[model samples]
Target chain A: MKAKIHIMLKNGVLDPQGKAVGHALASLGFDGVNEVRQGKYIEIDLAETDRAKAGGVVDRMCKTLLANTVIENYVIEFE
Target chain B: MKAKIHIMLKNGVLDPQGKAVGHALASLGFDGVNEVRQGKYIEIDLAETDRAKAGGVVDRMCKTLLANTVIENYVIEFE
Candidate 1:
């Protein structure tokens, strides 16, 4: 099984990197951009085959290491 | 309008960050992980309403500023 994860800063959390990107876009003359937010996308190939078990493992990974639970949220999908 | 973009290293490109992450996962006692790859997820809020135009604009942003086309591949989706 493969797990794809998206980890993003929670709402109300300040993101300086996103702000920098927005400013850079404006400086590059790309108009109409109102806001920019950046996050992490991770793909993990697992030896486990069972969907439910894989999900559990990946969830643990997110909670323990992949995501900073206080400031970020993560969504996981399996394939 | 909103645009979501995922930027990833092209296949065959060495990702040291990803390797480090994989190692970390292993050290954390999470087993059965074959590989781990990391990428970027970005969200942009746009004033433009037309989907076609927004796609064009986001594509240009990826080509010019958001992605290092030489080694990174980006996919853009609108919502």
Candidate 2:
């Protein structure tokens, strides 16, 4: 199975890197670009059989290593 | 309108950060985890009336700020 994990900073977190990129875009003459929020996409290949097991594994992945839960939120999609 | 931009290193690019996270997951006893590749997600709100204009703006954003084209690939979704 293949799972796609998306992790992003919570709405209120301060994202300095994202801000820098937004400033760079505006400087490059791109208009109507209101804001930029940066996040993470992680793809994992798992050999688990049951969907529940897979989700549990991914949840654990998020809680343990895939994300810093203090500042980010994550979602997983499996196929 | 909101667009989600996903950017990832092309296959074959050495992703040390991804590797480090994968190693950490394994060390934490998460099984069936074969590999991991990390990427980026950016959400934007555009006020353009034309979809093409929005796409053009997003393409420019990717080229100029959201992605480093030398080793990465990007896709944009419009809503």
Candidate 3:
């Protein structure tokens, strides 16, 4: 199974990196870009075959190491 | 309008960050993990209403400022 994870900063958390990107885009002459938020996309290949087991394992990984629970949120999908 | 962009390293590139993550997962007692690859996810808010226009603008943004086309590939989706 392959698990895809999207880890994003929670609302209200400061994102300097994202701000910099937005500013860069503006400087590059791209107009009307109101906001930008950057996050992480991770793909993990697991040996587990069962869908339920894979989901559980990946969830544990997220809570334990993949995501900073206080400041970030993560969504996981299996394929 | 909103654009979601996923920027990822091209296959065959060495991803030390991803390797470190995989190692960390193993050290944390998580097993059955075969591989891990990390990428970037960006969300952009745009003033453009037309889906076609939004896609074109975001694609330009990706090529000009968002992605390093030499080593990274980016996918853009609108919502």
Q: Give TM-scores for every candidate, taking all chains together and pairing residue i with residue i.
A: 0.99, 0.93, 0.97
State residue B74's C-alpha deviation in candidate 2, in Å.
0.8
Q: In candidate 3, residue A27 scores what lDDT?
A: 92
lDDT of 3 by residue, B1-79 (tens): 9999999999999988889999999999998999999999999999999999899999999998889999999999888
Candidate 1 docking band: high
Question: On TM-score, who's better, 1 or 2?
Answer: 1
Expressed as tens digits, the lDDT of each residue in B1-79 for candidate 1 is 9999999999999998789899999999998999999999999999999999999999999999999999999999999
lDDT, residue A62, candidate 3: 98
- Show pairs that collide, candidate 2: none
For all candidates, the clash counts are 0, 0, 0
> Model 3 Cα displacement at A6 (Å)?
0.4
DockQ computed for model 3 against the true two-chain complex using alpha carbons: 0.93
* Predictions in order: lDDT: 0.97, 0.85, 0.95
TM-score of chain B of each: 0.98, 0.93, 0.96
User: Which runs of model 1 end up more than 4 angstroms from their true locations?
Assistant: none
C-alpha lDDT (0 to 100) for residue A32 of candidate 1: 90
| Candidates by lDDT, descending order | 1, 3, 2
DockQ per model, Cα: 0.94, 0.82, 0.93
Better of 1 and 3 by TM-score: 1
